[model samples]
Target chain A: MERPTLDQIWAWLDQIPDPEIPVISLVDLGVIRDALWKGDTLHLKVTPTYSGCPATAVINLDIQQHLRANGIDKLVLERQLSPAWTTDWISEKGRRNLQKFGIAPPPKDGEHGSYGALLGRVVECPRCGSKTTERISQFGSTPCKASYRCTECLEPFDYFKCI
Target chain B: MADKALFEFLTRIGDTTLVLGHRVSEWCGHAPALEEDIALANTALDLIGHTRMWLSRAGEVEGKGRTEDDLAFLREAHEFRNYLLVERPNEDFAVTITRQFLFDAWHRLMLISLQESSDQRVSEIAEKASKEVAYHVERSTDLVVRLGDGTEESHRRMQHAVDILWPYTGELFTDDETDRELSDRGIIPLPSSLEGEWKTHVDGVLSAATLVRPEREYAHKGGKAGVHTEHLGFLLAEMQVTHRAHPGATW
Candidate 1:
């Protein structure tokens, strides 16, 4: 069998969806920092969305299993935590996918702000694209999200919180 | 260059987060609302993760065989170097928020300065922690305002919590010889120097919340010197029991 290219491995990884938000792939989430093949071994770098995200372990396991099934057995997964992960790293496609999946995408370049920004910022409802939404809580079903209610749609949704 | 000072500094930061994180974790499943339950638990998890990072690095620097778990679970209350403010009992929802708000504000300021430390590892950790602490500050500030300025009953409870927690805040900025040594080397900022910014930030939030700053008096001190309130022992007892009972047991 011809050796699979680095691009091919990434393609395989793209098939593995995030356990929490199954509609989006790990690549879309921007968690997969890098993937490189070093001779016979493949080295992968991953950054979690949050320092304490419980889903990190599950995501690591899933990556290993998915890549191993593709016959690339020698793998090294390094968790790079420096510079920290930010919501701005979420791929454009990931944001769109998250919105389509009923989770509001965080604002781009919303990297630095004060408490006032959190209170005053507006987030459109993912379900209806209605600009009328209010945050119910700064927390949601996951660590990286906030709970918001769409006044127009009368539906509750998660807003991928800006970190 | 004294390694002891460095070790002590690392432990001071680590133990504060570990102990306070344990306190925050206690609110899990018990918060007044579901959103608060998630928020507090999430904050606890973040603090615990930070504890592991700092302690693991401390162990490496100390050239000790102790792991993060060893430092966390094996140490007794007297050995801990956390601030007295953090080790206080979580008396109520109001108290928890009050404690968290004060600590979060100070923590963010400290971390912001630490990001410029001569120690690369410390700076990197501080950078990451500063971001998390910013969110924590925002969350706690919002809650403090909502509770303090909302109903009259809530305002009274919040005021009471502030009165109880305020005395302990002084110890957070009290620098000793170890802190002075580290400060001289630019490895860490003088804790007292950060007090000005802390006061400005904290006072603003309190004023906005329609809460009065408790009158300053004889402030509690000595947690950094391994002296803590009566609450630390019980907290450590409950926290350390499982690990002590089953040594080296892992699922």
Candidate 2:
């Protein structure tokens, strides 16, 4: 029997959509922390997108079913609680994917300088890449996001709050 | 006696969280800012989660048919065992922040001790809650210093809140027979031991805020003994109404 590769595990995980945000896969969300082959069994470590998030059970179930369908039967799912999840964990590709999917990605830290001086910040529109944008609400779709409206495109989008 | 005692201890813990969570939840729409509001609400949610866990465990240990909801919502004013510190109304943002600072300081220490509890379930819950409490303490301490030293009016209000709440702080360190048993068996740490650490952390923050710990001769007690202030009944009335009115109803 040959050892399974990371690519194989990644491909298997691609089938798992975020339970809360169905449009994105766990891999795209950067929540599939680690994958390893131990003996004939595969071990996958995942972190919840948010603390006390209710979607963890669904995510776990999805991962197990997806891996099983991909012919990896022996599986163990582990949850890492510490170090906490941050918006920075979302990858560049994930950001692009999120934008294309009509959900705005998290803003880069210090991009707006200090949150203390809030008005001068230039938030780029996720849709049209326009630099003119204004905050709609400090809170967005979830506790981890803020609502913003693009001045140029006039489309409202969610900006994942900096953890 | 043993079963009743266990139920009482568990209820004390649950009621403390429930009442404090209720008070904290009021900050939801009225916090100083959106971020602070979210933070306070999240903390309230965490406390409510802790209350559910402990109350459910209490129900199991009691061998009573009562579920967590029954214990939470069906209980009368005198049935609650929450400390007076958490039962106090949210006077102002300063009062809320000061109350939180004091409670979080004690809770952080208590949770740290509970993390090593011999009871595996207790230890597990404490381990998780400790992290959250640590953050709560940090946030509270930061706000205390900022507001205390921020402006003349802010400083006066912060100091006044601290003075008013200091009397309630002593009761948290007063342990009863249940606490004694749990501490002796390593199921929980001694409340007295946690007091020293709590005091050190609290004093450090107070000093930075240029606030002095008030010297009070009378410290309130008896919450753990099923005695609470006039506030508890009203709070419980609001919290328990829905569940008590519609028994065992779940959506």
Candidate 3:
């Protein structure tokens, strides 16, 4: 068997969708920090979106299984917590997918300034793109999201909260 | 020199969050509203997530060939070290809100202090946990104010909750030899140092909520030293039951 290059491994990882948000690949979601070759074994650094995100374990398993299925059997997945995962890491491609899937992608960090960032207070409706939205709760169905309601559309949606 | 103290200190926080996380999890389906149910569960997951990191670190420090699971599931109640304040039951929504508000205040302060820890592991975990806890404090503080200043019934319940829990809060600020050594090494903050800020924060919240601060001087102590109230045993029973029953079971 031939050893896959790091770029090749990343391409494989990019095929793996986030288990919870199946629209975006793990690479675009930014949880897959880095993939490297250490001897015959492949070592990858993965950071969780939320420290307590239940999907973290599934994501790890999916990465391992997907890589193994691709003929790369030796794998090591490391959990990286420092410089924690922020919605800032979600790629432009991933953000579009989230919006297309009826979830408001988080407002970019400096877009809101420190005041809005501190409160995470501004959000546009993912459904109607209306600026008038009120937070339903700081929590949603998942750890990485917050529940919100669009005043214009009257439709409730999830916001991928910025860390 | 501080390895033993560090291990004990890690267990103290690990178990505190674990017990509190379990107690919060009990509100999963039973919260007063659907949004609250989701919110409570989310908070529980975050706390438990922090618990995994803390306990795993504790196991590493102890070097006893124990993993986080071993430390969390195998320990008897007597072997556990957590705060007595965390073990208090969630009597009702008001009580739960009150307890979370109190703990989150101290937790926030402690984490902020710890983000500066000289230990790389400690500081890194603290840096990550600090962000999540920032949200916890915001949510808990908002609720404490709302419930405290709400209608008579809610106000009464919130007041009762605060008064009952006030005594246990004292234990969090009392420092001992472990705290002394750790602070000397710049690994962790002296618990007492956090009290001033905790009080100022809690006071502002209580004021906004229209709740009076308790004047009680007698404080319940000893959860740090592994002395616990009766509530912890039941929590551990339910928490550890699955692990004990299946022993090394994995999905």
Which candidate comes out best when scored by DockQ?
3
Q: Score chain B of candidate 3 by TM-score.
A: 0.98
Regions more than 4 Å wrong, model 1: A1-3, A113-119
Q: Which regions of candidate 3 fall more than 4 Å away from where they truly are?
A: A110-116
Worst 10 residues of 3 chain A by lDDT: A109-118
What does candidate 2's lDDT look like per residue over B119-219, in tens digits?
Answer: 76677666656545555665688889989988999999999999999999899888888888767777767677788778888888999998878977478
| lDDT (Cα, tens digit) per residue for candidate 3, span B1-251 | 33799999999999989999999999988999999999999999999999999999998899887888899899988889999999999999998999999999999889888989988899988888888887788889889998889999999999999999999899999999999999999999999999999999899989999999999768899899888889999999998899999988965
Cα displacement (Å) at residue A22, model 2: 5.3
Clashing pairs in 3: none
Candidate 2 residue pairs in clash (backbone atoms < 3 Å) = none
Compute the lDDT for candidate 3.
0.89
What are the iRMS values of all candidates?
Answer: 1.9, 7.5, 2.9
TM-score (second chain) of model 2? 0.95
Report the lDDT tens digits of candidate 1 across residue range B31-121. 9989899889989988987897799888888886888889999998889999999988888899999999999999988888998999988
Ranking by lDDT: 3, 1, 2
- Highest-TM-score candidate: 3
lDDT (tens digit, per residue) of candidate 1 on A9-78: 8899989999999988998888889888788888999987766778998999999999889898899999
TM-score of chain A of each: 0.93, 0.80, 0.93
Please rank every candidate by DockQ, starting with the best: 3, 1, 2
lDDT of every predicted structure (CA atoms)? 0.88, 0.76, 0.89
